[model samples]
Target: MKKSSFILMSMLLVFTMFVAGCGKSENNNASGETPKTETETPKESEAPKKDVSLRVFSTFGGTDTAREAFQAALDEFTSKNPNIKVENDTMSANDDGFRTKVNTDMTSGNEPDLLFYFVGADAKGFVDAGKVVPLNDILDSDSTWKSGFSPAALENVRQKDGNIYAVPLTGFYEGLFVNKKIFEDNKLELPTDWDKMKTAVQTLSKKGIIPLAAPFDQSHYVIEHFILSAAGSKGHNSGLADGIDPNWEKGYAAMKELYDLGAFPKDAATIDLGMASNYYGEGKAAMILEGSWAMGNWKDPAVLDNTTVIPFPAMPGGVGTGKDVIGGFGSGFYLSKSTFDNADKKDAAIALLKHMTSPAVIEKIALANGGTPAAAGVEIKGKTQTATEGFAMVANADSVNNPIDTMVAPETFSTLRAGVQAVVTGKKTPADVLKEAKDIEDANKK
Candidate 1:
């Protein structure tokens, strides 16, 4: 959406939401509309229910925290509308294969009725192909539903075309998650700055503890935090369409510096994000660079009890304030164009979409995942200490940014990710790797 339009919409929602006291009437339909029961009578017996089946693809699988809550939401919708049967299709999205699968399915004409995916360049393929419907008219048709969303959240997901094709559930933020108990036990100070971080890395590695639990292959968080902290918001957000920023070189250099300090696992190149997370969760590592959605997945009570998130400390000569963060409403639900055009599935799909993105469901999912709720005035109760610290970190941050992957083409990003191992292992200089990535970016633009 245009900047002016986003601002105007934000102002309108803020006024209306304040008038509504940041909440809607209780017992309303999942879509935020009050039930029409006062005027309509039961007619279940008058006609057979038109049965409809929907497939919802999301990342709420394995230890995603929101898995159970999402399934419960599906169950509730099924019970309320017996005619609609929802297949809760889910997958762990900690690896590149998930994106491959999503792209393949979307391109193969096997798109789900409702797909939960990223918002920016990651979505450009199916979006440009017209495989999904822009949700502007749909959201406008239902003021209650649109009103339930925070304007900023919707604004974050709006495409460059000045249209919204996705309805967000919960937003997220990423930072360095520390195991406080481990630090205390080792008589080490928390790595709130570069000096302290280096001390922790050296000391922890000497003690045979993983200083930073990160995988070289699935290094999304590592790449994101390092670049944002080193390059600051402006340089980081500057897409490769122009050229390489020198600060970006500093980011990779910092990663190499960490590698020399034994900051990564011995098998970092082989492990995936899950195993990296496992090392941190099992208290085998002092810290892990991760996102808010990852907080609830750690089952170790000791680790969970002592964990706190901090922005990756700013590096020497870097312009970042040491408080710049990475995150926002990065992902959301999209209604498939085929589903909308299907006369037999249109209403059912829309109803299911509304029910899933409802404030009530968003709240439940946020409570479970500790993500920033997209629904206006919806508060998360029973948030863990880690989540509380995360919120405070974001609230005090100088800037919040989306991850770098969202700004560039998929293949270009893949090249960047593939560069991490080579950069750290001395096989490639940061400049060389970035030049290769820039070449790929240039080709993609053509």
Candidate 2:
């Protein structure tokens, strides 16, 4: 009996030992200290994504519709990309010091991850400095995005080296914004030729109405339109790189003729662009020379209802036939090479740029500003008469040239503006202005 009792005790001890060992193994697996099978799931906290932040800069501020549209698109981007944060730094494009600020930041190596600025000669400095990233590879890799841009828009941003540094948003064209109703009310003909323009100016001036809202203080717009009208695209572009071409003399003379005929407001010599726009918007003036982008400022219903755009009338004996336009891809976005070099931020920055310049966003901007869209297949819905006329003028233009202010060096542009003002005010003749411009250009070359 004693032997049997001992055997039972031994068996029970063994069984208890086996069960305890099994429990230890199960605990080890649950504690995650042991290797698991391939079927095991990953924890939610494992391999978390790192958050990224980007700096974006632009010249879209104030109550401008472009600003609002850009903000909306940026908000949407942030919502979609919760892992990425964008810091927007904006300023007024109309600010005289805008270019100075941009250049300072860029030169100081404090550039934003993305930038909105003028293309062509204005962007050439950054591109040459290797500060801007060439977008050819990115655009080529993404066929959808590449196909959305118009060829002409792409060409405008393409550099002489065949590299594209920016993505165009909205292109612009310079023309005369006319009050059709005002002309009809006065029994005046639309200014289709130099003679008709003179007739219209005389009739309007005699009735105490300002025929054209001319602002000499900020006369770049006037100079651009007059030069393109007189010199044509080929003549203007050829002369802009060098000093003032002889063709520019014709442009200066044309502006002087208009000034002598009393086509401008009495205070035109002192007023700025804003004042000139107000003069036209308030129905005090029959016409204003402005770009397509200015359409947003004319929000007065009366002004909107009466306004239509037309090319400037042909200058007498000018090289241009009055069909040449002064405009192209005036502004676009530039990507920073430093931002794109970071392994983590590169993909996100590219994605953000693509999203910002997407077809939907571009269309929204165009509609809000009533400007020409750079993206292809973006139909301007609920078109204004002004926009319709502007588009028609662009489509029918014989050739499009960049504004002189955009093509020339900053000093030369300033000199040209002041010279044109002098000519318009009769303080200097066209020949005198051209000689002074040539001197400045020669000095700049040296």
Candidate 3:
């Protein structure tokens, strides 16, 4: 019996070992059949997505807070879309450096994917170069794109060729920003007409304050102001476009009155808009003849809180009433013809562009930075003092005039600047300035 029991136990142990060995063999077969590990699979998922980057050059000064806010928005966009990237290559706030960059790059075939440029001749030049893409298709295809912007905003971006080159974030109006407290303290009512404004200036000056802060160093701003005022004096609705017409007399005489009133600082000839803004912000001057951009600076804690913006004081018989605004269109992101030619980068670039200018992004940018919207229907979020005032000016304006510098041919900006300098420095009278500009324009027309 004992021998039988030992034999049975030995047999069961052998059977158990055999089953375990068989299971181990089956596992190895299954594992060895497919040798492709996760790492060994097609690398399409891991290959660093073709680095899609868009290079942008702009006229917005990088140092300005507005530029910084836009950059933040761009960063948010890139974070959400890992496949696309934007490279800000250059920023030129004023026209001089901006034009140099545009001409140099446009002629060299090294244009950026996006750029901030002028409306008339500059837009024409880009189209002639076969560079700027018409945004009509983009606008037509996307309801949000077409519906988000104001018609006035769209009009500014359209070229004579009926192509859209850019979009603007702000609708600027040339207006007077005054220290309300200062005026009320002086017992002065808000100036409603030219005579009242002139009187207000004299009264303010008597109190040892410069009546208005008008910058001379940056001729562009000064020119816009003068044009708006003159338009008001002549009753011209669109002063800039009117200036282009051969039959237009232009607003020279009205400009002369502002020049003679001693309305500006003692060294007004050398003051730039930036300096003039400082003068107004610090209360060194009672008011400033500036654009909607001025309101943006007021949001800063360093600026006075008691500021108010009003349109250029009315001219009795001028064609432009208090409602006419002087400003051009806003800017938009651009894509290089070369980038759009590439397959992967093109898809990524367009995707990112759409994302950045989407309703959400536009509202975010405008609200965060005290700016207006280039995208339609997106309400501005944050109400900075200046941005709010700026929008009011736009809403109240009956017409908008393009900047004279933007309308003219190349080098004409320089000529206009020089003429402005002559007037502010007392070297050339207002008539001389107007005649010089007319001569330049006439030559260009011929």
Candidate 4:
């Protein structure tokens, strides 16, 4: 079927399902004629008809793959409710493009009913502008919903004023993706401490294999490797969950040593995440530090299929040893107060939210994308290389440190990312980077 016709049919089916469930209402007098009643009847009004339509804004880029998944989700939601109709407005990948679209919509009083948000400054701005709804009431009224999410996961999306504006969909953990075959082929044991890890990298490098694969084009990934190197050395509880600051000196020192040893590629600074994956998939590198989201793509049957994930190796006398690493909730969903205030629209949107977040939906998304589900005990069909790797890292971690971007204030995020990138790229000394970060934080506070 044509795409437009498909969407229309899906929406129509949804409207039918919802309308079928609600009782119809009519106005009549006690005499059973269509006339104004002498005594107005006092009773609860009937639920509104299920013909309401809501628009959802998203940054999924609307690729055919994403569109198919979204349509499936909407179709399922409508099938269950049969009252609400949801249409999606997908945005482009260009960061400015999305911000422009949202801003335009907000100003024109044509804002969507819901939006997908990335936690931190982006979501904070919307909350500050009163463009997003405070979900505190909904959360408080629904016990099962409130209890379903992990506190750490939920905290990332909560507003500073103790009100929740978004519901997290899932979390992506970052870790080292190791080539198990390489380790076994070299008769090398997996490293559990700092000394062993260094020895392994050096040994593997001597054999003409790059020990670590890092995509340098994405500065954040490069910086995260540095952060993990420190976290692994310092241990997970050293209060260095704060990234790239002066307090994280020990971590920086460790990262610098790895750079000096040439653990990453000769031009690691230029390689993006995809290039890093190619390095590992083609057997040019032994491991890469990446987010769990990468798992889905890495596990594509077309790519190498023998890789496995593990925590960053340990460092002697470090905070939490190699077993402790960093991770947190990756993305979120939010509701608009304007949408919820309309009685017919409100019930329809709420029902959609609940259905899309149900255990079944969570499992499908996880299985399809190879990421972990936010909802507990939801069983998915399969695992991707990245997801399995993420699970391994999570399992090994004595504790998972929050990704700095998820925990720190918005203005500080850019400062933190830049500082870490500077150190990783050898453009700035660790001390210099740390000092700069401190100044930025201090200034933001003022």
Candidate number with the higher lDDT (2 or 3): 2
Question: 2 or 4: which has the higher lDDT?
Answer: 2
TM-score of 1: 0.89
Of models 2 and 3, which has the larger TM-score?
Answer: 2
Error of 2 at 396 (Å): 1.7
Candidate 2, residues 253-351, lDDT tens digits: the string is 888888778899998877878788889988899999987777787768888898888888778778788788877887788999888898888899999
- Tens-digit lDDT track of model 4 for 180-225: 7788888877655666668778888888898888744444554554
Q: Highest lDDT among the candidates is held by which one?
A: 1
Q: Candidate 2: lDDT of 386? A: 74
Clashing pairs in 2: none
What lDDT does each candidate get? 0.91, 0.83, 0.65, 0.64
> At residue 343, what lDDT does model 2 achieve?
87
What TM-score, computed on C-alpha atoms, does each candidate reach? 0.89, 0.88, 0.79, 0.73
| Residue 5 in model 2: lDDT | 100
Report the Cα lDDT for residue 283, model 2: 89
Error of 2 at 413 (Å): 1.0
Candidate ranking under lDDT, highest first, comes to 1, 2, 3, 4
